[model samples]
Target chain A: MPVQDYIRDRFFPHIWCPGCGHGIVLNGMLKAIEELGLSKNEIVMVSGIGCSSRISGYVDFHTLHTIHGRALAFASGVKMSRPELNLIIPMGDGDALAIGGNHFIHAARRNIDLTAIIMNNRIYGMTGGQFSPLSGHGIKASTAPYSTIDHDFDIMELAKSAGATFAARTTTFHIKEITSIIKKAILHEGFSVVEIMSQCPTYFGKQNKLGNSFEMMELFKKNTRKIGSNKKLENKNLIERGIFIQKELPEYTNEYSKMVKIAMGKKNER
Target chain B: MKKNISFIQGNEACVQGALYAGLDLFAGYPITPSTEITELLSIRLPQKGGYFMQMEDEIASMCAIIGASLTGCKVMTATSGPGFSLMQEALGYAVMTEIPCVIVNIQRGGPSTGNPTHVSQGDVNQARWGIHGDHSIITMTASNHQDVFSVTVDAFNLAETYRTPVILLFDEVIGHMREKLIIPEKDDIELIQRLKTTVSEGVDFRPYLPRDDGRIPMADFGGTHRHNVTGLFHDMWGFPSNNPKIVDGLIHHLVDKINNNINIIAKVKEFHIDDARTILISYGASARTARHVVENRRSRGERIGLLELITLWPFPSHIIREKCRNARFIIVVEMNFGQILKEVKTCIDKPEKVFLANRVDGVLITVQDIRTILRIVQ
Candidate 1:
C-alpha cells in the first residue's frame, strides 16, 4: 500500500521536524504492517504523549492516545481483553523507560503478547531539550545544565532482563534494518521490544551542535551496524552503530495459552 | 413451593450471584468482608471455564479486570477501604474510556485503614465521587443476602447495558453475615453480554458516541474496530483533541448517557408509610435493623415507616424528599459518622427535624440502637 494511502493524510505534513528519525521509524512500521498483511482492524495502536506518540493520530488503525507513560498499561488491558488482537505501543524514550518504566517491566515480565516500539532519541525533545533517561552521561539538557551525572539505561538490556521474549536495537539511520527488526518483533509471540535509536534534529541535535535533520540522520547511519554484519563497533566509539543485540526468551503467549488450556480443561471436567 | 433456603452470608451470596452472571474473570486481592467474594470465585471460576488471578495488589487487580473486560469478558474485583483507594485511578480510567466491568467494595471504617474486619458504610461518598472529575455511575447497594445475589447479577447487566463500571457497594456486616439465599439456576436467570458496535464500512467507528437511546456499544478490542482509546477529551473517533466544543459535547454525552436512563437506575423499597408520623431512612445492613425497629413500633400501634435505599447514587432525591415531606421526623441510620445523612439533609426541605443515629466503633447497628434514637427524637 502507498504510504499516503495508509496514513491519515489530513493529519500529515508529519509532525516531526525536517529529517527527524521518527518519520523513518514510522515508515518502517507502515511497511511492516503491509508486509504482514495485517488488516487495520486487527491492530490497536496505543501511544503516550510526545512527538512519537503523535504516530497514533497519523496511522489508519484503531488507536488510543492515552495518558503520559500509561500507554503500556492501557495496552495491557486492551490486549488482555482481546488476546486475539495485535497491539502495538509506540512511545518516546521518556514515556517507555522513565515515568512508565515500572509498567514496561511488569508487562514484559508477564510476557503479554504485545509489541512495544520505543523511539529513543536520547533527549526529551517535545518539552525542550531536557535530560531523558536515555541521554548520555556528560550531556547537557534543559534540566542538566552542567555535565550530566546519571548513567543512562540500556533499554534493550532492560527488556531482556525483564523477560521480553524478543529484544532488538537499531538506529533510524538503518531504515532497512529497523524495518526488518520490527517485522521480526511483530511476529514474536510474547512481549517484544524494538528500541529504535532515532534522532531529534530540533532540540537534541541543536544542543549537541549536530547541524540539522540531515546531520542527525547522518549520525544515526554512522553509528549503526547491520544485523549479522559482524562489524563490531566499540561502544566507546561514537560513530559505532549496529544491531548491538538480539535474543529470544520464552514468549508469554505460549505460557498464557497453556494457562487457558488448563483453565478450560478444569471447566470441562466440572 | 419457593425454596426456603437456609441462612447464608451476604458475601457468599455475592459470589453465587457472580457465577449466575456468567462472570468470566475474577481478579482481586483479599480485604475484609469482601475477601469471601474472591475466595469463592477463586475456586468456582475455574470450574466454569472462567479465569481467576490473585494479582500482586489492588492496582494490578483493577487493571486485570479492565484487561479481561476488554477481551469481551465479564469481570469483577472486590476490595475494601484501602484497596478501594488504590483502585480510584483505574476506576476513573474505566469510567472515561467506557469499559464494562464490575467493582465490589464491602466498606470498612476509615479515611485510612480504620476497621478492617468491621462494618461501616463510610464509603458512600467515595463511591459517588471517588475518582476525580465529573462522571455519572450505575451503582446498587444490597442490604441482605437475597439482594446481594439479585443486585450483583443486576450489576453485571447494568455494566453491559451502560458500558461503564458498576460499583456494588456492600458493607462489612452484610458482607460477612450469613443469611438464606435461594440460588437460582443459570438458565433461569438472564445474563447480558456487552453491546457490540458495528463498524460501518465507510464511516469511521466512533466508540464514544452516545446512541440515540443514550448508550454506547462497546467493541471487542481485538475482534474489529481497533479504536483510538484515550483519557484525553476526544471526539467520538477517539482521537485526542482539545477543541472547546468537542470537550463540552463529550462530557455532556457521558453524563447524559446515565442521566437519561435515570428511571431505570433508581431503585428503592418503601415500607408502612400510610398514616405514619415518622420515617426512618437507611440502607445496606442498617436498613435491615430499621426494618425490625419499624416493625416493633408498628406492633405497639405506633405510627412509623421505613425507606430502604437499594441504589445509593443519584441519591433518589425525589422519592426521599416526597417521602419525608409529610413526616414529623426522618431518621437516618448507618454504621458510620453520617455520610448518607448529609445526602438526606439535601433531599429534605426539613433538615432541622432530621435525626442521625450513627455508630463508628465497627459494630453492626442493632434495632434497639435505632429504637433508642427514635425515642430520643420523638
Candidate 2:
C-alpha cells in the first residue's frame, strides 16, 4: 500500500514547523506500518500533548490525542482491555520524562505490549522551547535563559533499566533505520521503546547555534554511530544508534489472559 | 427463586453493581475507604473474564479507564478525596472527549487529607465543579448498601446513555460499613448497553455527530470506523477546531446535555414530604441519620420529613423547589460545613428559611445532632 493510504490527507499540512524532524518520524512510522501490512482499524495511535503528539491527528488510524504525559497510561488500558489492537504511543521529551516519567517506567516494568516512540527533541517545542529532561547540560532553552545545569537522561538506558523487552535508538538523519527499528519494535510482542532523536529546528536548533535544519541533520549524522561499531572505540562520547535489547518476555496482556483462565477455573471448582 | 444475598461492605456492593452493569474493565489505585472496591474487583473481575488493572496512581487509573472505555468497554475507577483531586484533570478529559466511565469517590475529610478513615461530605462542590470549564457531570450518592448497589448500576446506565463520566460519591461511613446487599439477577434490572453506529465500513463515520436523541453512537477504537478523540474543543469528526462557532456549539452541547435533563437526571427519595411542615434534606451517610430523625419524629405526629437526594449534581433544584414549596423551614443535614446547604439555598425560593445543620469534624453526625437543629428551626 502507498504511504498516503495510512495518512489523513485532509488534516495536512501538519502543525509542525518547517524542517521539523517530527514529520520525518511520522513518515518513517507510516512506512513501517505499511511495510508490516497492518490495517488502520487494528492500530491505535495514542499521543500526548506536544508538537510530536500532532502526529496522531495526521494519522488515519484510531487516534487518541491525550493529555501530556498520560499517553502510555491510556495506551496500557487500551492494550490490556483489547489485546487484539496494536498500540503505538508517540510522546515528546518533556511529555515522556518530566510529567509522564512515572507512567513511562511503570508501563515498561509491566512489559505490556505497546510501542512507545519517544520523539526526543531535547526541548518542549509545543510551549516554545523549554528545556526538557532530554536537554543535556549547557543547553539553552526559553526556560533556561542562561543555559541548563541539569543533565539529560539517556532514553535507551532508562527503558532498558525499566524492563522494556525491546529498546532501540535512531535519529531522523537515519530515516531508514527509524522505519526498520519501529517495525521490529511493533513486532516484538512486548513493551518496546524506540527513541527517535527528532529535531526542533525552530526551537532547539536556533536557540543553540545549530545553524539550520540541514546543519542539525548533519550533526545527528556526525554525533551518532551504529551500536557496537568500531568507531565507538575511537570516540567514547559518540551516541550509539541501533537496537540495544530484544528478547522474549511475558507480555502483560498475554499473561493477564492466562490469569483469567486460571481464575475462572478456580471459580468453577467452587 | 432462591435469593442471592450477601452481607458485604458498600465498596463490595459497588463492585457487584458494576459487574452486574456489564463492567468489562476496571483500573484503580488504592485509597482509604475506596480500596475495598479495588481489592474485590481484582479478585472478582478475572473470575468473570473482566480485566482489573491496579495502576500506578490515581491519575493513571482515571486515564486508563477512559482509554478502556474508548475500546467499547464498560470501565470504572475508585478513589477518595486526594485521589479524586489527582483525577480531576483526566476526569475533565473524559468529559470533553465524551468517554463513558464511572468514577467512585468515597468521601473522606478533606481540603488536604484531613481524615482518611472518617467521613465528610466536603467533596459535594468539588464533584460538581472540580474540572475547570463549562460542563455538566452526573453525581450520585446512597445512604445504605442496597442503595449503593442500585445507584452504582444507575451510574453505569447514565454513563452509557449520555456517553459521559458518572461520579458515585459515597462517604467513608457507607464505604467501609458492612450491610446486607441482595445481588439482583441479570434480567431483574435493565442494563443499557453501549450504542454503536450503524454506519458501515468505507463510509464516513462522524464519531462526534449526535443522533436525533442527542446521543453520539460510538465505534470502538479497534473497529472499522477509525476516528480521532481529543480533549480540545472538536468538531463532529472529533478533530480539534478553533472556530468560535464550533467552540460555542460544543460548550453548549456538553453543558446542555445533562443540565437540560435535570428533571430526568435528578433522583430523590421522599418520605412524608407531601404534607410535612419542616423538610430535612440530606444525602450519603448523613441521610441515614436524617431519616432516623424524621421517622422517630413522625411517630409522635411531628410534621417533619426527609428528602434523601440520590442524584446530587444538576442540583435537582426543581424537585427541591417543588418538595419544599409548602414547608415552613428546610434543614440541610450533612457532614460538611454547608456544601449542599449552599446549593439548597440557591435552589429554594426562601433562602433564609433553609438552615444548615452540619458537622465539619471527622465524627459522623448523629440523629441527636440533627434533632438539635430541628429544635432550633422549629
Give the top-scoring candidate (DockQ). 2
lDDT of 1: 0.81
Q: What is the TM-score of each predicted model, taking all chains together? A: 0.89, 0.99
Error of 1 at B44 (Å): 3.2
| Backbone clash pairs in model 1 (N, Cα, C under 3 Å; residues 3+ apart or in different chains), count | 21
Candidate 1 residue-wise lDDT, A10-118, digit = tens: 7768767787888888999999888888888788888888889999989878777766677787676667556677889999999888877877898888888788999
TM-score of chain A of 1: 0.90
What TM-score does chain A of each model score against the native chain A? 0.90, 0.98
Q: Which residues of candidate 2, in runs, are more than 4 Å off?
A: A268-270
In candidate 2, how many Å is residue B197 off?
Answer: 0.3
Worst 10 residues of 2 chain B by lDDT: B368-377
lDDT of 2 by residue, A78-110 (tens): 998899999999999899889999999999999
TM-score result, candidate 1: 0.89
Native-contact fraction for each model? 0.54, 0.87
